[model samples]
Target: MKRRLEPGRLVIASHNKGKIPEIAALLGPYGMDIVSAGELDVPEPEETGTSFAANAELKARFSADLTGLPALADDSGLCVEALDGDPGIFSARWAGSGKDFGRAMELVERNLAAKGPEAGRDAHFVCALSLCWPDGHIVTVEGRVDGHLVWPPRGDKGFGYDPVFQPWHHDITFGEMDPDRKHAMSHRADAFRKLVAAVF
Candidate 1:
């Protein structure tokens, strides 16, 4: 079957370096010539959505319209059950004035400090991917990984909330794990798997 996305120079509606590789890896199998919004100086739209799916669609649709090409966007964050599922949409802002995951991790630990150990500090990382075409058709997919947060952080590989997020059945954080392993269990992988299936 011919892939709906096809093979072409497409745009990723995000400026984050961390997201590009994942998106590229996911779409590469289908033979896509992926491009990033940053490469074209496309602006990132403010994510005003209350959920990951909404935000992904917002970015993807906006970029697709702006570039007149299919666009892929992802919105992902860590949700800690102990914090009332907090740091959900605010995961990026947990660090306060900047995009500092270190500060973000600190804030999470502080928030859970008073709750004490095993205070349902359980967390899961969620990723939502949106694919939009210039013709106004859009498809979205979501994926999640059950995990927990560890204090003081660990490893130095992955970014954002990676160092602190320990996946189920793993003693090390996502940052500490191999990229292949991380990608296998990652929320982005799950969503992208669904997305590729839909597109193809």
Candidate 2:
């Protein structure tokens, strides 16, 4: 069984500035008083989990426990098929402590090049969402968007590895798409749809 999210102040358990706004947009229609853990000065818990779901739940539960309010958290990253899903959970860590994603994208390209002509550039983005209550109840969902990797990373929009990922049918990378357009078919949006259907 799962608990419904009542319209009230809900904690968004994330310190990433990029993710907060995207999530806020998804939850906006629900009319909840959304608050971010960063805004609340809640410390980020160590992501000790090996998978996205575990990490999302960990963050959500931590915020819920601290604030005594329901919390929502998401863990997302890029997984390259050629890399055998390398940099899955460590996606952010690859950017270094300064969070320099530009260099990180370069690193990804270098790794692919090292694979020679046999490299399979197929890749996908994944997002896992978790909703947690102070009482320890939780609900979770996951989503993924498949695409192939492109060289010379295009566009200057979006964040992370968006510039290098071109979805299956789209000519432009995520970095080239408008925020609203990306939001409509993003992995985060897919997960949000599930979370909305199940919990809201």
Candidate 3:
């Protein structure tokens, strides 16, 4: 049987400025008193896990254990097929210590250019979410949205590699879409839906 989350305080176990708000927005409808690990001054744990789900659980478990509150963490990234998932788990690392996504995006474009015209632009975003309780019980779910990469990027909204990705069947890139539209079909939202069904 799956565990259910009672209406109460919950910690969002992430330090990324871009991610915390997106997550908080997703959890807003649930009526839990949402607070972030950053807000609580909880230090980020090393994400040594090999996959998104593992990393998410690692963060969630760390925060939940420390704060004695239910914690939610998300590990997500962009995987490019042409690059054989070059930056998959290292998506954040690709941005370096400064979190310079402009440089990271340039690296991706440069690498793709190295592959020549024949190399496909096929790509997708993956999000894995983990919810952990103080006693160690945890639940995890993953979601993905297929898309292709675009040059010069687009839009000023959204964060990370959103500017360069155009989901299949969408005319505009994720960065160009309205937040509500993006939220409706995002990889994170996909995972959140599953999470709500399982734990709410």
Clashes of each: 0, 0, 0
lDDT of 3 by residue, 1-200 (tens): 77899999999998888887788788889888989999999999999999999999999999999999999999999999999997898999999999999999999999999999999999999999999999999999999999999999899989999999999999999999999899889999999999999899
Ten-residue stretch with the least lDDT total in model 1? 1-10
Task: Please report how far candidate 2 places residue 179 from its true position, in Å.
Answer: 1.0
**Residue 185 displacement (Å), model 3:** 0.4
lDDT of 3: 0.94
lDDT of 3 at 171: 90
Descending-lDDT candidate ranking: 3, 2, 1
TM-score of 3: 0.98
Worst 10 residues of 3 by lDDT: 18-27
Instruction: Report the number of the highest-TM-score candidate.
Output: 3
Give the Å shift of residue 44 in candidate 2.
1.1
lDDT of 2 by residue, 19-80 (tens): 88888888989988989999899999999999999999999999999999999999999999
Which of candidates 1 and 2 is the stronger one according to TM-score? Answer: 2
Residue by residue across 27-100, what tens digits does model 1's lDDT show?
76787888899998899898899899999999999999999999989999999998998899778878666688
